[model samples]
Target chain A: MSIKDCLGIQDEELVKKSLENIDYFACIYERYEKKLIRYILRISSFSYHEAEEVLQEAFVRVWRNLNEFDESLKFSSWVYRIVHNTTITEWRKTQSKGKDRKQDIDDELYKNLPSNLNIEKELGRKIDADGIKRVLDLMPEKYRSVLILKFLEEKDYNEISDILKKPTGTVGTLINRAKKSFNQIADKENITFTV
Target chain B: MENSQKLLDKIQKENIEQRKKSEFAAKNIFFWTMFTLSVLIGGLATSVLIFAFGQTEFDLLSHITHSRVELFLGMLPIVWIFFSFVFLAASIALLRKTKKGYKYSPVLVLMGNLIMSLILGTVIYFSGGAVKIESIFAKNVPGYQSVEEKKTAIWSAPEDGFLSGTIISVENEVILQDWNGKDWKIDTKDALIRGRVSMRIGEEVKIIGEMSSEGLFKASEIRPWKGQGNGANHVNN
Candidate 1:
């Protein structure tokens, strides 16, 4: 039988199972760590830190509430939805303040990445990865998430759609748009696109 | 090359520091709780003996109220906690005022505590009539025991796994509504409900759902519809 038959299990029962059989669930996290963290980072302003914390929280939540999961919806999709909800909640905290304050933090985080990047001039003149990261950091959360899933995590269009709970077609469009946005920044920075 | 390498090295160092910082979380706060508990039990026993045998004055009213509350509703964890603290403080204060040649000694104090507690216990034990509060939302319904939930599903497993019950109609993602039965919502999440849905008919598939607080079953996990008593283990789905 598929997993959906196990839906309505008790939290205590799941916790007991998790405690007894750590490998069953631990394997899930170990396999998906990079993709999950990148997905969370794309959703949050504090990508690295928030992503780590939220990923850990999401795993703990899954571990603690395993018995609560329904098998009808794919487990990966359900877990991604929870991460999406967590990101939205975190975004709301920053968004709750006045618009000006929100925009201010946004601009600070989304500024021209290469301008801030200190690629030394005298000794070496090389295209820096950090500089590229800074520019990628500027794209809006939705677009950035798609880009990371496409390039970094190497998730396909349908998988990205499932992760973000967006329509598959929209995921495809956003990925194209995200590439365009990244290109614009790269062109403006005078960084030669190798490919 | 030197500056670029230094910058990368610095970022790497910073990332390592951040990861290490995350690792050193706040220590578990429950470790030292038992030490405090031992002191409390000892102090209570000492004070009871002192009050019963004649070392101090015993407030009979306080004893009665405490006994009543405890008997009526088992003392809450927090309430018992504050109580332990109060007793500990009072015992410390009483012992501090050690007096010589006093008529009320530990012997008399001990006797008073025992007699007062004994009397309060007797009064409370006889009053079995529970104080019932009329809930506006819960109009005279039966207790939690009256809540019953039934789920039916037929599922097939191409692979080997334990099978539960079959789901009829799922009301909510978490709450299960029978095809024609009473429905309730389950609060908890993460369950399995399995059945094939071709948009034609509902299958009698296997289900494993939890009974919820609102007297409804939630269906999260489900397998393809199939019969039970096969090879795999099964719970009522």
Candidate 2:
């Protein structure tokens, strides 16, 4: 038999096997470390505090419920869904607090990022933190989520679909609409996104 | 002119740094893995236990039985998906560092041990794991039984050949280990690599080598687990 046939079913046995194999979790942890952090950072607006808090909460949920994973669904999709949910919850709380969720001037997550955020690369003009936040706040939550997952987190449409639990095509269409919505906000703010 | 050049360089550096911060970190990866592990294990454990323990009339496999909770906890590489959260919650609780913490600490520790036992049960289950380690090891070993006992591997590979099922293990970033019922040692030199598990802390692998192959394949993929060495880019812990 081919190597494929050699393994048992991806059914209950597989699930059981995974739990007994604690290192399996480590294998999984390696897969999405960067993308998730990036997503969390973007949603949390580079707020190390909020991102750290959300990270713990999110992982706690994931670790505690690892077995709940449905094999048929793509793992990344399920993962993104977790991060998205965790991040959204975090983001919402931050929004509710109505405080600037900025990282400390010298947090390690900044990787030696300068005291001044370089928003100037925009269309040869500086896009200050205030400007970006203004536009981001004005954007609908749905639109903002899409944009962040797409651009900031670098997730594809299908992944975004899974994360958002929407249809693949719907995610694609919404991303387009989201971009448009972002532009509208930028226009209203009199801030060119490129700027 | 020099001062202007310095200013521009600093701005550029600041921008790059800003972008990096907005990018990602290790903690992010830790949590993602933790969550996936929990959800996958929890959901799968529940599913399998429901099936394995619920009503398996496999006849010969009767000894391979336990309560649903036991069965669920008994397969694969064991870890308590449910209890980690409880501990984390307790960690938060303990953060208060009050008499309340003293009161709740024992309960948290008990839960931790409970999870440990539950995970260990799965470990024992895989040793044939369905019934008990002595029984399972007495007869045969399943490639993937939840880890219940510390000494047992959640899965087993005889390092030679197998009877059925494919095993998967990630070798060097370029080679993918393939297991097909046959027990075999994965020689990284001859393997077809897939994605990398780690580039820094050497490699973290479970050596039931055969079944862990993640499904057997003729090594053909180029640069299998070869990561962009992204972890190196991050500030390593």
Candidate 3:
């Protein structure tokens, strides 16, 4: 069996093994590589090359600071936080250089995300991924990130709070505001959904 | 795929250059030591304010009930509180740079700083750290003394109030260095002296009087300074 299947273990256990033998870290990288790329693509104004750079930088930081990885937090949330910070920093650097790059949602990645979203159920309509993407592109970065994390990634409010480094209450408030913003932007863009 | 290989190579190389166990521990120790020192200093500042609040002869709780806005807001120790707050802010700012700090929200971090300062302040206050700090400021720091003097002059007004200080001279007339650091001549002819407290030179006394002139005060009542940090009573024999 490969290292990935060597042990059908928890991420935390994988992290523990990785700390001792650096080669074991490849398991973690393999697990989150695609999801993180898609996350960076959705939230950050980085080209594919820049997003790849951010992903590499983020994994590097994760590997270097694995010992500091808090056992209390989920390994996925910790990795997401590292990636989120790296992407934002890279985005800001490019922003200062007056280079604005916007990335579209990858079709394959979008298809792979969780489909049984409560947002569709709540809206009482079938909202296609293209329409959601259009609304997200029109919304501000803060609102967009919250909505994507809640709807697409299907993360709970507390997990989103941990990933975004915000208070749980603030995360709830942001999710509410993000939904309102999404609906308002969709209405303005003349996008229709059967209610 | 190729990029992951490249990053793996870099990670392995960087891991080799990572500091040793002792060095890492030393860095963390240095950070924690600095954090602790700043917190203690902040606590000391808070202790000084707590001590000052405790030194009041008047019933502060009564004032809160009867003239709360006037007493609580007007007489709040803004200077000492400001210093304590600044120190606390410094402590929290320092803590935010620590390894586990980013885990807390800013409000939670601030609340933690405040609570730690209050607990530390209470500890210092009960352990007499506040008294030592007051004396240290009074003797060593001239600037601190001047600010304290101004505060005393305003709060402990001679009109409808009293002055507490050590007796500087006791010839035919009484001369004392008032709490405001100014010398005053006390006309003590008809003053009622209470307690078995003596009239020795350098003995602390609380004199209730009105400022008669610029540099003179008339005594109505005289009593021994009978609280913490005050000299013990020596009955006149």
Candidate 4:
């Protein structure tokens, strides 16, 4: 199929075609490349270069395990799941090697956070993007990941559940707790939110 | 876009092949088989646990000790209960490894496992499977005690006004061999025989009486060794 045709086809269809022809796999990689790199950077201490490496490895794994993919799950969720696992494994490897990688969220990405988070109502003061970023960085990885997936990535509960391989109820609970934790960290840091 | 092309080019150069669908199918089948086996084992354990509880003489707690807690603790069947929960947890963990297993909450999974075990266990218990399995374990497994053996131990305290034995003879004076193979002459003339008390030879019986002398037991009441074998209660006056 042509590049235009591949772009028009759905992810599930692309996955089926990719199995028959390796070239079709390029469309799958291209489709998720940008979004997944951003996801890896948000959830891990990886730099852009390292995140790209992880994404590349993750896509290769996705290719090898294509037949194992459950047809019932959304293709986007499956790809995200692979990316999440791959990033976490790499993160652990870096930690064990005593590499102290600084987690940095892009300032531009922070500015794009949705306003519906109701952080202003919870903190009783208007909080800026930088203040939110600080609170998120200080939170535990589990809570931080859930918040990023839910609020920043604009993923629903079901999507988060599929990506994390957690129950939807657990996903909801995690998001609520993550928000509470984020607020607590904000309060503890005593960041002066501009009114 | 550059990295994407790089990956695609690498995939073509290396000729990376997708894993066969049968591998995933086999892995899924293995997990499901293990999950089912765990549940079935758990159910069987539950059945044995129920049977053990059923065989216990809870009514005789008053006779054993003043504290109900002591009697309860003594007859709790800890081994069977442990095995049941161990297998239950195993089943739950195995189920969670399946593709769609994470969709269900832990509470829901636990409840589902418990219900399946209870239903399967009850069926097995009623079908007498529990009794046969219990007996086999008691005989083969070292340090494993059956409910019947436990009951015998409870009722074998001749000095404490309880004695149980197989009847050697049931004539003017009952000749019985206690669980420890000691012979005793039981005087049941003034005894109240409760339930379906079969005073036939080789029949096992429990006597609530004191050791009058060396090999003699003066009986006040007699009961079938198994359960309160319900029938017409009689007096051997």
Minimum summed lDDT over a 10-residue window in model 2 chain A is located at A113-122
Q: Model 4 reaches what TM-score against the true structure?
A: 0.88
What is the C-alpha DockQ of each candidate? 0.01, 0.01, 0.28, 0.76
Name the DockQ score for candidate 4.
0.76
Which runs of model 3 end up more than 4 angstroms from their true locations? A1-23, A70-72, A101-115, A121-128, A138-143, A165-170, A173-177, A180-195, B1-3, B9-35, B56-79, B93-112, B146-152, B155-237
RMSD of 1: 31.5
Worst 10-residue lDDT window for candidate 1 chain B reads B145-154
Task: List the candidate 4 regions with Cα displacement exceeding 4 Å.
Answer: A1-5, A114-126, B66-74, B159-161, B167-176, B185-193, B198-203, B208-221, B230-237
Q: Highest TM-score: give the candidate number.
A: 4
**TM-scores of all predicted structures:** 0.31, 0.35, 0.70, 0.88
Angstrom error of the Cα, residue A164, model 3: value is 3.6
Model 1 lDDT per residue over A1-195, tens place = 112333564434443454445533444555456667666654565546656667765665554455445444456666776776676676667667632212113333223322443322210233344544555656677777776566545566666766676657668778778767776776777665221
lDDT of 1 by residue, B1-237 (tens): 332233224434553221221222211122223323434453443333222223111221132323445322322223323444555444433432322112233445445444543443334323421111112112464541100111121111111121232233444433333444434443324543222321112444333344443445444444444322234433323
Predicted complex 4: CAPRI docking category: medium
Best by DockQ: 4
Model 2 regions lying over 4 Å from their true place:
A1-18, A101-134, A193-195, B1-237
What is the full ranking by DockQ, best candidate first?
Answer: 4, 3, 2, 1
Please provide TM-scores computed only on chain A for all of the candidate models, following their numbering: 0.57, 0.67, 0.86, 0.89
Q: Per-residue lDDT of B12-107 in model 4, one digit per residue for the tens?
A: 789877799999999889999999999999999999999998887776666644456855776788889999999999999999998788999999
